[model samples]
Every structure is written in C-alpha cells, then in structure tokens.
Target: MSSGMQRYTRRTLAREILLILAGLGWLFPLYLLLLTSLKPDSQIFSAPTDLPTSLDVGNYAEAWSSADLGRALFNSMVITGGSVALLIVVGSLSAYTIARRPGRWSAVFYLLFVVGIIVPSQLGLIPLYSMMRSLGLVGSYVGIILLYGGLWIPMAVFLYTGFIRAMPKDYEEAALIDGATPFRTFWRVIFPQLRSVTATVATLCGILVWNDFFTPLIFLSGTDKVPLPLAIYEFVGSVATRWNLVFAGILVALLPVLILFVVAQRQLMRGFSGGIKS
Candidate 1:
C-alpha cells in the first residue's frame, strides 16, 4: 500500500480505538448500575466492586413489586405513545402546510412555535399546576399526555418543517395532475417520504417523555399515575436510601429507551442528516 494510505489507515484505527474507549467510559455507570442491581443488599455495600458470582434475579422482582414498576411502565407507555402519535400527526400536518404554502399567517404560527422552543417549561410550572388543578387533570393520564404533546410540539414542528421543505414538489404536482386529492397525495406520496423524519421525531420525543421526571413528579401525585422516573424516585426515603432497589429501578427505567434507541438508530441518523441538509 502507498505510504499516505498506510498513514491514513493508522489514523483511522487510532480514532476508532479512542471512540471505543470513550463509549466504554460513558457506559461504565450503566455497567455499575447493572452490577449493583444484581447484588444482594449485603453484597451491594461489602463487595460493591466485585462482579456477581451468580446473577440474583430477586432484586429485579423485588424492585418491580416495591416500586410498582409494572403500573408505572404501563402509564409511561400510554403517555409517551399518545404524545408521540399526536405530535407526529399534528406537527406533520402543520409543517406540511407551512412548507407547501408559506404566507403571513403560516409564518406567524411557525414563529410562535419557534419561540416556544426557546422558552423553558419550568417558567410555566406554577401556572400549569394551577391550570391542571382547576381542570381536575392532575394525576390523570390525559393531563400528562397533553403536557408532553404541547411541550414537544415546537421542536417536532421545526424538524418536520425543515424535512418537508426539503421534499421534492414534483411528486405532489404529479399526484394532483393524476387527479389525486390534496389529502390523498400527501398521505400516499408525501408522507411515505417522511418516514425518516417521523422516526427521528418519535424516537427523540419518546425518549424525552419516557425519561421525564419533573412533569410526573409535579403532576402525578398519585402512585398509580406515576411514570417510571417518578416511580423510581419512590425508592428513596426521607431517612435512608435503598441503593440496591434504586439501582434496580433505574435499570428498569432505562430498558425502554435503550431498546428504542437501538431500533430507531438508523432512521434517527438519517432524519438528522435530512433535517440539517433541509
């Protein structure tokens, strides 16, 4: 091989090694959490560094029951799923309209959504809490779903708008020329092309909604309504901490996001690239 090519290969290998090391460094905490969760209470403190000689599945079972993780998981699934679905549907339609027909009204509405992205949700917490209480929505699935949908709309719409603008107009024009209705054209031709963006939005929003702690903590006062993050918070008490159970609860909470990332990683990357290009 040429000397230049050899040097380039060496540099690439070095970069790969560095990235692997960095990835392992980042994952070390998760490994420790997994190890801690698998250990008994006695083993947790005494031999915290020691790898488990044999996996102890009881901690997982205990953690599940103690934290009511099953119920929390269901609640999180319902809220996150509903929020993502609504965001995709609403955000996509809004974005498509804005992209296809950019006028003063569309621009104004889009600007409002852009402004929302800059404003922190914490600023509205007090009013939001009062509003929820007045509406009798606190501790209700519908309340959290609405909050997630509203909070995530700005970013979702922004991403979708960028993606839709990048899409070719030829397909829509052809569909119209072929006697297709506007709705049918968008549904059949335009929407399929947006799969990458849709996956990106869903995965990103799903992760955020799934891992959200503050919203659930403030709104889901009832144990039954608590999502995984809030449910995991219950593992700690006023006087002491249940480290084993806490770690176990964390692992349980992490599983869904991890699985989601793995499944949607390719489309997520594509969507990001498409969004940036757009």
Candidate 2:
C-alpha cells in the first residue's frame, strides 16, 4: 500500500481496537450482574470473577412473587403508553403548527415549551404533588400519566418541531388545495410524514416514563399502584437478605429497555437523524 494509505489503515485499526475495549468496559458490569444473579448466594461473592458453576433460576421466581412485579410491570406499561400517546397528539400538533407558521407570537409559544427542557422536574415536585392531591389524583394511574405527559411533552415538542421544520410545505399546500381543513391536512399529510420523529419521541419518552422512580414514589404509594422501579425498590428493601434475588429482579427490570433498544434500534437512531438521510 501507499505510505498515506498505510497510515490511514493503521489509524482505523487503532480506533477499532479502542472502541472494542470501551465496549467491553461498558458490558463487563452487565456480565458481572448476570453472572452474580445466576450463581447461588454461597458462590456469588466467593466466585466473583468466575462463571457460575450452576444456573439457579429460583431467584427469578422469588423476585416475581416476593415483589409483586407482574402488577407493577402492567402499571408501568399503562403509564408509559398513555404518556407517549398524549405526547404524540399534543406534541405533534403543536410542533407542526409552529413549524409551518413563523411569527413573533409563534416564537413566544415555541419558546415557552422549549424552556421546559431545562426546568428540572424536581423543582416542581412540591406544587405538583399538591396539585395532584387537590385534584384527588394521588395514587392513581391517570395522575402519573398526566404528570409524565406534561413533563415530557416539551421535549417531544422540541424534537418534532426541529424535524418538521426541515420538511417541504408542498405536501401541506397540496392537501389544502384539495379543500381539506387544516386539521385534516395535518392529520393525513403532515402527521404521516412525521413518523420518524414520532417514533423517536415515543422511544425517548417511553424509556423515561418506564424507568422513572421518583414520580411513582411520590405520586402513588399504594403497592398496587406502584410501577416496576418502585417495586424494585421494595424488592431491595424487603429482600435484602437475598442478594441473588435482588440482582435477578434488577436484570428482569432491564429486559424491556433492552428489548426496545433491539427492536427499534435502527428506527430510533434514524429518528434523531432529523429524518434527513444522505
């Protein structure tokens, strides 16, 4: 090979090796977690680096029964699903309007939601909890659904707006010329085109809502109302004696996200690419 080509090849090889090492570093903890979870407690600590001599799945059974995870998983799905649904409706509409129409008033409205990206939800916990309580929404799925919806809508709006802003208005204009109302034009023409951003928003906010611990802890304390994260919290406290079980529960909790990432893996990345492909 030419001298310059040889240098480029060497550099690519070095970069690949470095990335492989980093990937291993990130995955090693997960490897350890699975390893520890499978080992019997007697062997967990004793054989820290060694592979489990035997796989014990009793820990999973104990985690499920002891922690009431099945119900919690269902609740999480509902809250997450509801939040994403609300976000899609409100965020997509708002973003499409803002993207298609540019004005001082529109700018102000857009800015209002954009600012929410930085406002930490922790800061509003006090009044937010009070409002939910006043509305008799405490310990209710709808209440947390609204909370997640409200908190995440701003982020979704931001993403959708950025994405929609890049689109040609020709499709919308053509739909309008065909005598469709604005909402119909948006629903049939514009919204359909926003699938990439919608998927991205759903994935992003779904993960947030599903993994959230603080919201459920504060807004809903009933054992039946709690989601997976809170159930895991209770699992840790109640099953402290069973480290293997705790780790097993933790591993179970990670499965949804892992599955989501695997399933939407490509589309999720594309969504963030702003629907712009080379």
Candidate 3:
C-alpha cells in the first residue's frame, strides 16, 4: 500500500507539472499580444518578448478610432448572436426529433448531418460565394447570419442529439399524458432541462462565428457589412504595420469570448462532460 501510494503521488506530481507548462504555453500568444499593445512602437519590434515598461492605453484608443470598431463590433455581435440563436432553435428541434424517433431513416438523417463535420468549410467556399452572389445576399447581415447558421448547425445538432439521448423519456411521456402537445412538451419540459448543453452550443457557435474572417472577407466587401475580424485586417493594412495597434485590436476582439468564458465556464464544462457521458 505504501509503495502504491508513493507511485501515485509521483505520477500526480508529474502530471501537475506537465499541465502547468502546457497552460503557460497556451497563454503565451495572448501574453505577447497584450505585451505588444502596451509597449511603444519602437520597443514593439526591438524585443518582441520583453515585458512592457509601462501600461500605455493609447494603443487601445487608437485601435478603437482607426478600426471603426463601433460598426465592426455591432456587425459581429448581430451576426454571431443571430447565427447562435438560429442554431439553437434548428439544431435542438432536429436533434430532439432524431433522438425520440429512433429509426433507420432518423439514423440516416443524423449521419447525413454529422458527416458534414468532416467536410472542410474551405472546400465549399467558392460554391458558397457563388450561391450568395446568385441570390443577391452578398454583403448583407442576413446572408452572413444564414451562412453561419447553416455552417454551425451540424456541431450543435450533434451536441444536442447526444445530450437529448441521455434525457429520461418518462418526463416526456408524463407531459404527453398531461395533454401537453408535442411542441409544448418540448418547450415547457424538455428544453428547460437542456440548459447546460444549450449554453455550450451557444458559446461554441458564437465564438466560431465571431472569429471567422474568411467567410466575411469573401461574402462581404462593403465597409459597413464587415465584421471585427475583417475590420481589424483592413485596419492593419491601412496602418502600415503598426503592430502595437494591431495587438490592441486583437485584444479588443477577444473580449466577448473572454467575458463569456469567465461567466459561463461552469455551464460550458458541465455541458461538454454531461453530453459525452450521456
């Protein structure tokens, strides 16, 4: 027993050290970006990894004005929010149906959607661009929101399916016997129990849509339609390589995801673990 305990202790110590190192490695990029944002432009390139001598917030102010962040933030927020909302409705409903129905055709339908995850979005870029152009939906918020909705649906559906599968059918049956219609049963009873998985879906899909640059770059050429990622790209180009300002813009761009993670991290973790276990 003593030998076994010693071995376990050694293993746990090693694991903790490895995890700490990995955590630091993952945070290095963010640290560098913040460091750059605080440094003077002369010091930015001189020693990129050196700690900033002072916390100068002027870079953030410059980024805000020069990047037209007001419009960009609004566009990104609207698109990301709309896309996540659509995914929650469509993905959850489809997943619930697939879970409760449970037949060969349902399996096939789920397979068809799950298989989409294997197909890289870049592969469909040209066709997607052409489709938007043909439909006269290019450079519009609704078009990009719809595009994100379709692209994000598969993962959300997959998550919701797994989570819904784990749910007790007794509650659903009880609701049915209580004279609650199928739709009402879902909204009133089933959907409320899905808080964890739904939060996970919303956060994951929101972050993806928020960070996406290429889709907007291809479909949205107008300044007003451009999201934060594209706005930052254009700002960098116009600034003639002022990396201090660039880092500031990136930091600002990361704020929403950071805030969301800080607030909903517990829910996100529960969602993923509960989903996988179910």
Q: Could you tell me every candidate's TM-score relative to the true structure?
A: 0.93, 0.95, 0.95
Rank candidates, lDDT, best first.
Answer: 3, 1, 2
Estimate candidate 1's alpha-carbon lDDT, on a 0 to 1 scale: 0.87
Q: Candidate 1 clashing pairs?
A: none
What is the full ranking by TM-score, best candidate first?
2, 3, 1
Q: What ranges in model 1 sit over 4 Å off?
A: none
TM-score of candidate 2 versus the correct structure, residues matched by position: 0.95
Counted clashes in each candidate structure: 0, 0, 0
RMSD of each: 1.8, 1.9, 1.5
Q: If both were scored by lDDT, which would come out higher, candidate 2 or candidate 3?
A: 3
Q: lDDT winner among the candidates?
A: 3
Stronger candidate by TM-score (1 vs 2) = 2
Supply candidate 2's per-residue lDDT for 274: 89
Least well predicted 10-residue stretch by lDDT in candidate 2: 269-278
Please list the C-alpha lDDT of all candidates, in the order they appear.
0.87, 0.86, 0.89
